[model samples]
Target: MNKDVRASVKVGGQGQWSDHEKWLIEQGQQRIKTLMPEVYKTICRYAEKDSNVWRIVRLGLVGRPDQFWACEAGHVAGAPFTQFKRAVEVSRLIARFGCAHVCMIAGHGDLGGT
Candidate 1:
């Protein structure tokens, strides 16, 4: 996280964070199950495809996304439980499988959508 946010996290008494620090980190990630409520669909689709355990998602910017997926999901990382091969993959899953819990505010996509 940035220096300012780190500085803002109020430390609990006696060097104990009491979970606030960890919670701040999780919230910064911005991925939650509510945004991708495809549990039933995923279960039903699993039998037909058997790719649930082998869901291949190709996120860019370095590391092998498909390789460390289990650990990543355990921590609830990028795009939550899904991965994006391209731009449309983001919206497609969000549309069909998504249940939606977005907060746009008075702005556009984060960081100008890069």
Candidate 2:
């Protein structure tokens, strides 16, 4: 399993997707599947066939982890690449895995921190 899928598995809710969100996730998933065949394979290796794991991964990037952000006591993992760096890493991971586009969308601040 890839880090994003693992991170996403940690979240909750049955991902009621809006049309736009669904479209984006599917687009990312398709791109990843085509561009980074290895990453997709990794995801397949890790995720449950019945679960919307890719959706969770996308949500993790676009939004915050529901569990972590839900509770006032919870916190984001203070990694050096939490935001943009992670996004870049994700992009690289996708490309390294032969993915065309990154699954995660990041902001400028997401790139600058750490």
Candidate 3:
């Protein structure tokens, strides 16, 4: 998906930052505040103060248009569970087998792929 919207600026680590780091953090916070509310809202919905995990999956350390994923902490209980690919497979399976097979398919988890 398009990461033109992001929660990176608000990626935890606040209050304990140094002056210079705080400035940068504020800039990121500003970016989120001033530039992208849709992204920010998504972040708010998926991210939490002490729960949830938000990781930016980029090609390298930094750049643009990276993939951002949200893990429902309660769902996996601390394990990061991304349904990006799994969701796709479920879609395909349901197309063929119908919704009744969802439990059967989901029970297989990664569908033998990782």
Candidate 4:
């Protein structure tokens, strides 16, 4: 885990995406499928099946979770990404699984800090 963070982060740099990043992306996909099925469906609807945004979502790019956050919070005034990044759900997910786990699930991993 440390190796992933140390070797692949933008500052030090692997100059390429890491295996761990790929795995976290996969885990995020599974989590969405299992835990946020409705959001998953909405993603399929809005982002559309197999579209570029959907593809990004699969890679853990923090895509549609933003929309979910907006809906749940009823705080639709700001950018969806802002809602997502600051939401309670995301905070907990990061605390539990590390930032890489959620970074791009719908959006960049933010140089990937915990």
Candidate 5:
């Protein structure tokens, strides 16, 4: 629930949200609503029924995952502590290189696909 552990970081050394950034937040919120309505509703509850109240900040020093969501306000007693991470698959690697290569690198198995 702590800020550092949550990977929350200031944008451009300023904790302010620009118009474009706000637009991106709105788009992300909408995507969550469409993909996972239940979770989106829960986040809205944490934001006090206003999705716009939720702040979208950048996370630092992480790879693979494109985004990470965490609620500091929900970390309090009797509240829900939830976290979500979004990641995208590499189509080029999956198609051309194949899972065998990825699996070996990921410690799943060797090139034989065992």
Candidate 6:
């Protein structure tokens, strides 16, 4: 059986989205639609299937994920929920399996040959 793990972290603060943040989310969605139509369609389908509501969650940190896509289903037994997160560029490569290869493919320059 699968178990859900919930942990708490200090959020620092929360505020309304700024113009740039809103624009970034818009642009990100557009890019996803264009570049990965299948993924975008999957998100839409899940959103509709789980709940007819799509939510964009804002994180309180910059240089991190700009937006998170989730389907909102009110408290119910065996409710369906799904989340998608934006992928960012890898800035540093650590000594791990396939790190060097991934860094090369991502064009993050050589990381001292890993």
Steric overlap count per candidate:
0, 7, 0, 12, 0, 0
| Residues 1-114 of candidate 6: C-alpha lDDT, one tens digit per residue | 001101211134345456565554455455444554544555555455443113321221111322232221211111111222212223221223223111010111232111
Estimate, for each residue in 1-59, the C-alpha lDDT of model 5 and write its tens digit: 12222233343345544455444444544445455444445544545633222332122
Q: In model 1, what are the clashing residue pairs, if there are any? A: none
The models' CA-based lDDT, in order, is 0.29, 0.39, 0.34, 0.39, 0.31, 0.29
Runs of candidate 1 with Cα error greater than 4 angstroms are 1-37, 51-85, 88-114
- Per-residue error for 106 in candidate 2, Å, reads 16
lDDT of 4 by residue, 1-114 (tens): 122332333213326545665555555556556665555555565464334444444323323233222222111211234434345666666558653222222332332212
- Candidate number of the best lDDT: 4
lDDT of 2 by residue, 43-114 (tens): 454355524544444664344432001101121211123433354665466447653322222221133223
- Clash count for candidate 5 is 0
List TM-score per model, in order.
0.21, 0.40, 0.32, 0.39, 0.31, 0.36
lDDT tens string, model 3, 5-93? 23333334333334454444344445544555454454454344412223332111122122332222211111122444565665566
Q: On a 0 to 100 scale, what is the lDDT of residue 27 in model 2?
A: 54
Report how far residue 18 has shifted in candidate 1, in Å. Answer: 30
Roughly what TM-score does model 3 have, to 2 decimal places? 0.32
Q: What is the lDDT for 68 in model 4?
A: 25
Worst 10 residues of 1 by lDDT: 53-62
Comparing 2 and 6 on TM-score, the stronger one: 2
Cα lDDT, model 4, residue 74: 19
Runs off by more than 4 Å, candidate 3: 1-15, 48-114
What order do candidates take by TM-score, descending? Answer: 2, 4, 6, 3, 5, 1
